[model samples]
Target chain A: MAEAGAPIIEAIGLTKTFKVAQKPPGFAASVRHFFKRTYKEIPAVTDVSFTIRPGEMVGFLGANGAGKTTTLKMLTGLLHPTAGRCVVDGREPFARTRDFLSAITLVMGNKQQLLWDLPARDTLRLNAAIYGISDADYKSRVDELSGMLELTDKLDQPVRKLSLGERMKAELLASLLHGPKVLFLDEPTLGLDVNAQVAVRAFLRRYNERTGATILMTSHYMADITALCSRVLVIHEGKLVHDGELAALLRRFGTRRELRVELSHAVDDAKLRTLGEVLSHEGNVARLAVEPAALVAVVGRALAELPVVDLTVHDPPIEEVVGRVIGKSQRALPNVVGAEQGA
Target chain B: MNAALRKMGGLLSVYYAYMTAYRAELILWALANSLPFILMGAWYQAAAGGAFGFTPVDVTRYFLAVFVIRQLTVVWVIWEFDQDVQRGRLSQYLLQPVDPVWRYLAAHLSERVARLPFSALIIALFFLIFPPARFVPHASDVLLAITFATLAFALRFVMQYTLALFALWTERASSLESLMFILYLVLSGAIAPLEVFPPELRELVMWTPFPYFIWVPARLLIGGADVDLMRATVVCVSWIGSLLVVNRVVWRLGLKRHSSMGA
Candidate 1:
């Protein structure tokens, strides 16, 4: 249900560079550089560009320092690009006009906007005031968000006293109180348990469905991508490597399938190896990795040969797929000097 | 303008609630800043009968006023700004519709709002213990002193905040702030009154904004409110204007060059 109307966020040749102090491994070099420093241009996000239509939830996949967060910051107007143009909702983000700021929200997991010593409810009200929300609107929004997130009981306690998961929920409430049209989420579900992750993912999906606000999210967790985002953008070494449907990206890069077999009795390792590369064997269950083409053949024979009670085939995990794709991109790392870096 | 002021009022109240919740910590800080009370006693012993045209009663009034003025004007925003830039906590504010300056300024002002009453209560207890400390000014003088104290607070805050923007370049900006703090202790009438200094040195120190930050307000309240009010207000306003201009320049440059490297 994401927007197909027009692009709300766009970046054209966005670039950012930092002057990194370079020093040799000696006290002499250190002292010399301290006096007359030698520096090099470490490009954080070099000539990157993309466009996000309204109501689209897109995932950004990359390794650490691969310019994922840098690109997000540039898009959010936190950093002025060293060389290019970025406009969000038809206004330059760096200008940070009230209208532009009110239309967008950036949620960074490492930083918080909540009052640490007060209740989350207070912070939410403070945000409402800052965003110029009326009392009726503020109350309705808080009620809706807190009810959806199942955090009604937790809003009254000090933020520091809440668990990690509750605090993240409160963060989501605080960020969404303004009814922003665009959301920039960087690792919003970091350091949470599986159940909490599922809750947050569900809330995000529901929120997107309800509000139709476009969301651009960067996450290391594949579940976050697969569960919430339909489209994905994979960046490696600060260059866009792939951008398409999540399933298609997985198929293009997901080379292996897992074969899970349930045998009547514990099987020997040798027999299991005859079918495919045995990943694990414990009791009557066995998981094996097989080529995509051989997946059916392997599962068919394993059921007939062994005293198999059940068999299932599933796509390879996303971590392995991401690693493989990033590895290939690293090997093909061309002399990408600031110019050929567009999506 | 009305909407912005209303928002600021709401923010200040919210932070006031936060301060109430964290009042225990504020109490500890009140106790921590009581080192000046000891210095007050030292001054009393050194100038037993009279010294430097300051009688025993003058010394008592000066330190009490110093204690209250220091409490009203001191700010830790530099340390906070340094940490925010270094740790990238500033991104949260940058994302919002408001300027981070107003948000932090409200926070700093609200904290003083919460803690000022506690300091006043302590001053009352001091008055009970020390008879010579009872020096109440006229209503107009109190009003003027309040305005001057506010300007003084703004000056010191802007100066520290503007310099703290240096954290965009280095992590040790607070170290520089520590040196400035030492100068305030010596010259701002925190350690000793400007009345006790040599005429030449005192004249020079009084001309700078440091004395205005603490000494003028202190003098207005306790030193018989006898000093030149017009010149002091002019100097405070001029200092505020210069510091605000520097802050705007530094803030722009810092934001341009900031990488927010850590987070």
Candidate 2:
């Protein structure tokens, strides 16, 4: 067993490349390709490394196809990395020994392990057996987890009959039945309603607090991250771009503040450009992007120079900040934003 | 050991519930394997002419036994395994401590349990429709036939599941099973008993695993089958063991190649 406070999840220079078949268009090309198909090496994840200590909830931030899921698959032993090493709970994940499997769980939002035709309880029973949870332990764990997830009343219903939120909650319960010390959740709140998302997030927080289990989650919903995770990892183009506190990510890409201005009279587009980069300009109102350090100067200049009715300065949304971090090139990222050594 | 039993029991009971949940489908699947009953007519005419060294009664009884054997030994792991791999469902099973094959194995076993009553009902209806085909076998013969039929199911499952493992490389691995199943139909006595084959051909077929699948068990249940029980047992066990070794090797390599797509 790993010592308390030790890193429960570690990835060192992990890399994964997939050989994808490329189909050419056209009749001649189709026949020729069928006979001798070509393949391209697509790098899904590259030279990524990070360490997550026990009980830390780390949000993995990335755009679609940004290797967040690929990294999770490697950590869960669902896919073997082409290069590098990963150890979860003191054992190689790909080895998938009984001890290692018992210590970790992977939950995917779009994919389910539940038996759709049967009650969620049936699958939970099967998982308990597979994980070697005794009958008494199984009952207690189910009671505890279902209560925590607010799904105690829905266990006996067929999974297909449950609401999407209820089904997702049950999936969480099934994955947590074994009391895994580490969780790799890929968009657990995907497709959930606002209230459902909140419920899942709260359940995860409570789960972490109660079990001290390390959680690494990826979600398109920024609310999921901001609600539960103190730290975040940002991956861009299969490379680790940023790894630190969530606030640091905002501060890094939070350089640009959105300035919304309302004017009493029409303002020249060219004159608005002088204050800052004009994002959008209308008859009298305009929006500009300005650096935080120059916010006061820009605001004062805008108010003095233009017939401003009202002006407001706001920080960019967390989604756009995280998006820029993921969408930017590795070269564009600040030098300090890389995998934390000795994390 | 007790924990293992509990796990097995859990898997079996859960899958049994899954199978029984679709009662109409269960009956339909049982009836789907009644190809032997359809083929009985053609063989019965040939036997009536004394061309196959048997009476008409022999043909009817043989095919009846074949129907029961087919019901017991039917397997579709290849389809389920192929879809699981292609859709990334197998990754969920791989995350657990137990081998994924046991889940498929349990499903097959549970389906068999769910299917038994229907098969028995169909058999009883068949005997009622054609009383001439009815015969009481010795207790020993029934026991041996059940044993061999059970082994036949194991052999068939291992073979198709081994083929299914290729889905890791190529998503449509069921095509391989389809190709092999063609050979099974032709040589496994599903179409006709081994008694109709020429002496040399019969000898060759006996050496293969095909006859042990249907002919050996079917003939044993109906009597008058000239089979070496000792040789049949050895061959069945050997094929199962050999295929199992190949299955494991393929499974390991398949896991390495698994992309876990679509999840």
Candidate 3:
């Protein structure tokens, strides 16, 4: 049971396994599989547990197929756990009791709850009815969300006619109309442009602050996590790897820093090597990895004696930090950014 | 009671929204559901010169009543259930406060209400064109018809939904649904009267629940009010009640398996 004013979300030893059919590729093999088949039990979520207090904005981070979405589904009562138990507001999620469902909401980026051919407002009205919201509460919440999300102009338009960003804003409004106490947001900003992503992140933060709703969000955009979450839970290969403050994860796994320098005269790779590991050198521009404590001295030496034109020092990009934390090879930095963008 | 009424109202609101969302689709479905009336006209014309237990005029009344009763009692649970499972929309409903089945029922009933205006027009036109002597109303028959029709709808929805659970394991559930429909068409007297079937088949149909889906209710609506019809109404209600319990059990067991397999 949840203590009065305690965490609204709790999980213990949650696990899920899927039995997927395994078939060899080939016409003959396919024919054989029709008669005789093999199956493999793949564990999508291992024994993982976490507690989220009321009004806490927590980011869930993991690589693709790392079980973050699966965990979210379990929390929202979409999928029952294979083993162990979970409770949302002191009720078992899979039971899906009326009171329990009325108190929580799940918003998925790609999936829509809105009626596609109808105006978003229709869906909003439907949700209001489903959640049994009072007319005044519904109107006020819609007004507030409309102003913040800039959805006032688009609410009357059919969802199919709206742009992706517009549709997302409407979706957000529909989910929040019920005024759920807990929110499970799965990649809620997926496929949105940078500006749209920022807008969504800001809206979520404000909504959380204003409503005191506990929010659990999963996103590949480290920027979203960095801006919105004080704490994060990272999972890799269906197992929890790290759970702590976002800054601490950055501090522990974000070891390397990038040093980009522009030289007045093109310097040879050998000279750049003496200062630090030369990450890249082309023409007069070069990038290097410098020790965090020795960054100033290295910059000073390069500027005083070396033919330096410009220099800037910064921590390694978040994509690289996350990739390393997940045990991926760091030899390919550009691919890390690509992977994160794809996610 | 207040809570229940509030929930029902909420569900009706959602149903209205869904219908308004797909007004064009709703129009198309209403047309399709009335196709049986067209078949009735053709069949009635074929038996024009001869009396086959029903005159052409009586055929008109009987088929029109069937049309109205069918419209009221029909459910598309199998299709909706199959689509939800296939498209993964079942998750959204499962997470909601209300049982997914109740939501399905609400949506279905809402569509019925929306189409009532059009269906009432058809009923009115049929009565005006084919005024028959046997169209007299009886209080007992009216009550029995309502009771049987409600049970028939519930039984059919629950049974089909239970069958739809087979999709969790088998990929060919649609084929199974077609087979179920065929059984209903032959034994439930959706295509014709149950008594028209050979004695052996009628006996089999009587022992099964198929007649309760259509034949019993249609018979009651046609003023076949008697103690036997009352007994059949009880049997139909019992079947619906049993199926409801069975559906709950199947859902519990299926959910257990789904959780274990992580679907």
Note the DockQ of each predicted structure. Answer: 0.56, 0.48, 0.39
What's the C-alpha lDDT at position B84 in model 1?
A: 83
Off by over 4 Å in 1: A1-4, A24-26, A255-272, A278-287, A290-317, A327-343, B223-225, B259-263
lDDT of each residue in A1-343, candidate 1, tens digit only: 1234658988888887777888998999889988998988888777776777888999988878888898888878887788888888888888878888899898877778888989999999889889999889988998899999999999999999999999999999999999998999999998988798889999999999999988999887787888989887777666776666777666657668888988888889999999889988999999998987887787778878999998887656656777776675566645221222231
TM-score, cand. 2 vs. native: 0.90
Per-residue lDDT of candidate 2, residues B63-149 (tens digit): 999999999999999999989987878888888999999999999999999999999999999999999888999998999999999
Residues A1-343, model 3: lDDT tens digits: 4578766888888898888889989999999999999999999988887777878899888888989989988887778888878888888888777888888888889788877877898888767766778889989999998998988989988889998888898989998887788989998999999888989999999998888888999987777888899878777777766666777677666656789998888878988898899988999999998877788888888888688778888657655665666774235433432343233
Error of 3 at B121 (Å): 4.1
What residue pairs clash in candidate 2, if any at all? none
- Candidate 2 — what's its lDDT? 0.87
TM-score of 3: 0.82
TM-score (C-alpha, index-matched) for candidate 1: 0.89
Give per-residue CA lDDT, model 1, range B1-263, as digits (tens).
98898799888989889777877788877767786788888888877856567777778878877788778887888888888876777778878887778877888888898998788888889989987678777777677667778888999998898888888778659998889988988898888888778889988887788998887887777634567878887888988899899999988878766743432
